[model samples]
Target: MTTHLTGSRDEWLAARIELLKAEKELTRLNDDLARRRRQLPWVRIDKEFRFETDEGSASLADLFRGRSQLLVYHFMFGPDYKAGCPSCSAIADGFNGIAVHLANHDVSLTAVSRAPLAKLQAYRQRMGWTFPWASSSDSSFSFDFNVSFTEQQQREGSIEYNFAREPAFEWRSGKEGDGASARASFAAMTGTDMQTYTRDRPGMSAFAIEDGVVYHTYSTYSRGVDGIWSMYPWLDRAPKGRNEPSGPWWRRHDEYGRG
Candidate 1:
């Protein structure tokens, strides 16, 4: 009763073997790209950026936590959002498990958001995540990274994200196609208006601290983050690889049965 292609044992094995060869090639190419990523030059961070965390106020350097390398997952939990973005939350669900191994491997992994420390703490408790989550509420950290935008920017269509300047997302007279519906749905989930919901963006930034100077090594956004998504790769091997037609077919790991 299968709806997909069916084949005899020998034919299936032959196809699988061919796929395995391509998979190995992709793996090698990924390894090469990773090496190139590490080779990207570093930009020194000179501004005095501060954040509020469970450990109290800390500087950008403090985020490194004695490790030379630091990785920050830019979580989308704006100051006005009642809850975190479902998509960002889904990505963050895997953070706790990786934090331990990364800490031991000379890297500190942290999640940074524009939400207040109190809100972040509350949400972290709700999600049962023990990894360090910090607030950039009192700082321009998110703005400097271009993951957070302002009302004027949204109105003027001057939003910059994913390393490109694009029209800001405004629900009223803007947004097109599935992007609009996805924004509306996520906005409702966060208990905020569409404009406010789109104020923050999701991304990852990597830094390296050498001789007490923090350097911005590399940053990735949009689909570049798919590697860390943790599930998409597995789904790619499934019978229907992420067969989402209109919008995202995912939710926060904690919210799977509301319907």
Candidate 2:
């Protein structure tokens, strides 16, 4: 095994210089990534979708709420699901603060979910969030944007692709005692509409700012929820047992539960 030695002053200085070089390389890599992210093509969305807000029905254009631009977050809160996803809940928690700042910049942010207006409002109240959230109970918007699933697909235990061209699922199970099996039986309901057949493709929203609007800006599912938490100093804590995780404020936020 090759062990690193730190004995003389020259050796320590060399190690520090190497660390600074690594940091500079990291900075250069991050700049390259940002440029690549900005190079993604933008898609124009002209189709209008409807949603239910606190002020009643509103069109997708109306979601801009008379502002020049709008940013919609496709929050994961399907109708049949018992509660909003924990990971999504964490993001929504961040949105409360972000909404205020975005508005100050003349940008409006709204969260869209498949849950009914009443249900969403109740949960928002429970979470004590002030961000504007709307319900897409009547629109095929989620499916059109690929964020929800259909009833027939749920019943068939698979997803029909390309206008009934192909069917896909995780696994198939045999019927009781008959030994007859389906190819994909592990499918679950996407909790979307039945009539229009909306597919469940989570994270299908857009980000709009000055100059132009960007569709499907960025999306995430799980544990990476910690990605944005570093922005808040109060929430900035290292992982357990990594270096220092037993600071005074580490456990102080437990009273807030999952928030």
Candidate 3:
């Protein structure tokens, strides 16, 4: 039998009512944060970047697809990897459905990666996703955005990710320590080595166009992008509330054994 606490309906309702007050306060605070996010100053983008899309080739501005706003998911798929990151794949699974709704609302959502177009296409096909994905293989867009780092950056130990320069890790080809082992597991899942896996990091960026000028509005990396994950909000209300003591327990939808 389960050992979870049980209570009378009246007791449960009283506790729930108190929890509701906290939830409401969080909702209000979130609304204020969203307002502040929109009010943040945008940086003007002047670089002439190109990408390979299913539609052949396109410019960064073209990604807006005539919409005034663009949101790019910096998916962690490098040129050296045979597949997309498992974590990113799980996040992208929800995009196909939301992309349509966002497009109708004047925002275009696309995923940008450092992988070649052919590899991205194959992976997208395998995952059955229709969201627009563009390749920055020949462009400096990924580096400029700090989502893709170089070997030199790793050696210097001063790479900016998630907005701040992070300390260097003692990265090895196939290192076997706490962090290294976890990196190795993810790398193997994507059919790449640990070195290749660390080359690309996950992030999301927002852009806006005004008077034909493209401006970067905001970018978030690491756990900051968790709000975009469709599953988490639902799980937050569950009794166990993520219950992820063993780290990430999800895989690409197709990778799961359940039918």
Best by TM-score: 1
**What's the lDDT for all of these models?**
0.88, 0.58, 0.88
Structural similarity to truth (TM-score) of each candidate: 0.94, 0.61, 0.94
Off by over 4 Å in 2: 1-24, 151-204, 209-259
Q: Which segments of model 3 are wrong by more than 4 Å?
A: 170-179
In model 3, what are the clashing residue pairs, if there are any? none
Residue 170, candidate 3: alpha-carbon lDDT = 38
TM-score of model number 1: 0.94
Report the C-alpha displacement of residue 155, candidate 3, in angstroms.
1.5
RMSD of 3: 3.1
lDDT per residue, candidate 3, 1-259, as tens digits?
A: 8898999999999999999999999999999999999999999999999999999889999999999999999999999898899889988989999999999999999999999999999999999999999999999999999889997887788778876775574333223223655677788988988767887888899999999999999988877778998888889889899776433467788888964
Sliding window of 10 residues with minimal summed lDDT for model 3:
169-178
